[model samples]
Target chain A: MKTPVYFDYAATAPVDPRVVEAMLGLLGPDGDFGNPSAVHAYGRKAAALVEEAREEIAALLGVAASGIVFTSGATESDNLAIKGAARAAARRGRHVITEKTAHKAVLDACRALEREGFEVSYLVPDRGGRISAAQLEASLRPDTILVSLLHANNETGVLQDIPALAAAVRRHGALFHLDAAQSAGKVELPLEQVDLLALSAHKFCGPKGAGLLYVRPGVRLEPLLHGGGHERGRRAGTLATHQIRGMALAFRLAVESMAEESSRLAGFSSRLIEGLCALPGVLLNGHREARLPNIVNVSVEGVDGEALQLALRDIACSSGAACNSASGEPSYVLRALGRDDALAGASLRFSMGRWTRVEEVDYLLERFGSELTRLRRIAGAA
Target chain B: MDELHDPARYSPRVLELFDRPARLGPPPGANREGQAENRARGSWLRMYLQVEAERVVAAGFHARGCPHTIAAAELACEALTGSDASELAEYRAEFLEAALPLPPEKLDVRLLIEDAVRAAAHGRR
Candidate 1:
């Protein structure tokens, strides 16, 4: 058995070999390394590649090619979607709505708006990390012009009922922004009513420095960056042809294989959950049936979270969101779901991906059980 | 030493002690035990001492904490094993802290260890 195994796919996935192959074509001197903004022949060639890739990504999402605005990645896309839309509609309203379990990108973007005097409502989710449509509808007011929420919770893989939530926002005439960073290319998205959606390329095995935000036609959003009017004046940096092509190709590949891949990963997820929950005092974190099949998060009662994290160094799993790991704080997402700090901090999130095998899952389970027992004994809990 | 060392986060010495804390669990015929908790970090340390003739003959511990806290307790047990029982009254984690260099964030674990030693001393009297 490999000493160190990887199970933290939700943090970031290994770049697909196909994406790497396609990206190489546009990077070297012999490649199409032309400035996409240039009016010259090389520029035209690069621009054509970018547009084709855009069309492919857009087709995968079932949206118009013109709606996609390529950005650095999901962080930028989310910032652009939330702040850009909020600032553009400031005259219409100063209120925005989001959930407690949103990604920091969405939450922080809302925070920035709050500093600018925008009133932001952070709706707490149900104990299962779910934000109901009625909860959202009750919070929406005449002045609430934007509602930003993620389609799936990154920490626990708990999926929100986006269609129902989006309908509530629509009824209030507020623009809905979906942070589909975890769901896109992995699940079939019902996004016909979503006005703005954020996508991270790396989440779907694409390049890291690439992502896009879909801006529905007729929705006004102020540009985040200012320069030569790239991305139709929505995002202004010079286009990265290679990254864009890689992202597009990666999305296409994921969507093409999603059906079989989802089923395979769901099976792995089920087996892992069963093995883990069978242990005494181990509690599953998310809604059992309403979560993404790739991520399995559970809390081990009476186990030292930090010690458990240290012992499981052989398995590349997370105690919480990778972004917040350095802070040494209990996951705010779990706390929002009413888990005490002890249980919240003790939680482990194991996410599987395309390359994960059943053997690897079994190895993780075996290692987890032994480690739990050892740590419990050390703590005098066993 | 296992592959658990994140050099930026933990010292090799800390990992060594955490992995194989030989002094862990109650020493044979321990008559007094004291526990301390750092609720903020959700960590705790319990220290047990076997005292005879007003001298600590054996010491052991059980802990639930980060590597640094557990390692500090392990080192604490070693330091307590041969000391006069009264020394626990004014025991400080300064020696343990010096032996195992820690980052600024984990400095509180020292206080927890000190509190456990004091608690053990209080229980003995």
Candidate 2:
């Protein structure tokens, strides 16, 4: 069977071999099978493994080890960060601020918060999936206590100016939580002023079952899962030793190799951009030059994004809109850019990853160009 | 490791299953009937097929998705021939198991094929 090229890395990445190797020691009966809470030698060994993993993950983000709390993955980390922070600081303020296009985890958490009677100011991002810092500053109300913005958009790969946004959020003394699921290992973020940050290991080539929430000093969160007071009463469960160890290894490898990896993915992503741009009536979506190095979103007029995706099944790219392929509904991110639904619906997001290569990009460029040309003609596009 | 997104060990059948894509819209002449067939690509919905057929022959698909999707639909139609709607409903991964593997992301293409089958069942000429 021919191996298909994978371009949807933002959804989740394959675990790195380094991570898989690191996890092996924790899996077998002879490994660290002792429950972390058991004070015996075995338990102590397990506890040490968990703590060491914590330190490694924290160090990757430049945060104190104590601030890192491991969870099942990014979704849980996001839930814990947003919902926990909202509850922990609820008395200080009842209003929370966040932007649209946040991963569903953040948006859903905010929605849940609203259900619990907290008022949330949903910031509509500017075109390119950016929520303006000035708009955020203006949206601040005295009652607002937490501001959560995604560090990088999952769909568009648009990187938010976290430090600038964080600096503004600080003025109101509102706690800031950045959902760094897309950025933590892919790019460096300013840790200062980011009260809490969430990351999932899978986004950075780690195991899917492990993730961490960075709660800066003095920032506290109510536990999401209740048990034997694991994670200092924040998240409760027997630690997932293998997954946690794998995540730590993944983070270390990603942090150490981020520069070269970023450069490689940038080249790959631009290759897609250049290739897609060569198609007539093609449009590039997202903030030009302001997005993550690996993401290239574009729209070919008269070609349905999903249809194009279907045509080029040999290359596993993505369409931003979930609706029908023939009928055009613009991408929500593109719509935020004031593009009518047609342009938005026509948008496609192609993200490059560590495994991406020039050969794969070449195949993708060839397949995509032909697919668009064929789909246009088949769809009767004049 | 199969523990992750390992496409490495994917068998020919598994690869074909993941890669073979069905169409998203019904065939060109399908909508004239009471049923409007919508293919989701992985799972198919054939509602309102209130009768049984002795001999069935149909030509379909207005390619709405991609080459793989169109090919998958064509493959589905060919496979479903000489079979009844009930037989069509039970069509499993074999067609694709014989074809190219479907990607995890494009798995919906399979459902679209099923939808085409149902559309063909109640499908109007």
Which predicted model would earn the best TM-score? 1
DockQ of 1: 0.61
lDDT of 1 by residue, A34-149 (tens): 99889999999999999999998888889999999999998999999999999999999999999888999999999999999999999999998899898999999999999999
Poorest lDDT segment (10 consecutive residues) of candidate 2 chain B: B41-50
Model 2 residue B102 lDDT score: 57
For B1-125, candidate 2 gives per-residue lDDT tens digits of 12233443244333342244343233443332222223332122222222335433443344445334555555555555445555544445455534645555556667666655555554544
Per-residue C-alpha lDDT of model 1 across residues B33-105, encoded as one tens digit per residue: 8989988778888889888898999998888887788889988899888898978889887877668877777
- True lDDT of residue A83, candidate 2: 91
Candidate 1's C-alpha runs over 4 A off are A321-328, B1-5
Where model 2 places Cα greater than 4 Å from the true spot, the runs are A323-331, B1-125
Q: What's the TM for model 1?
A: 0.97
- Clash count for candidate 2 is 26
Give Cα distance to truth, residue A319, candidate 2, Å. 2.0
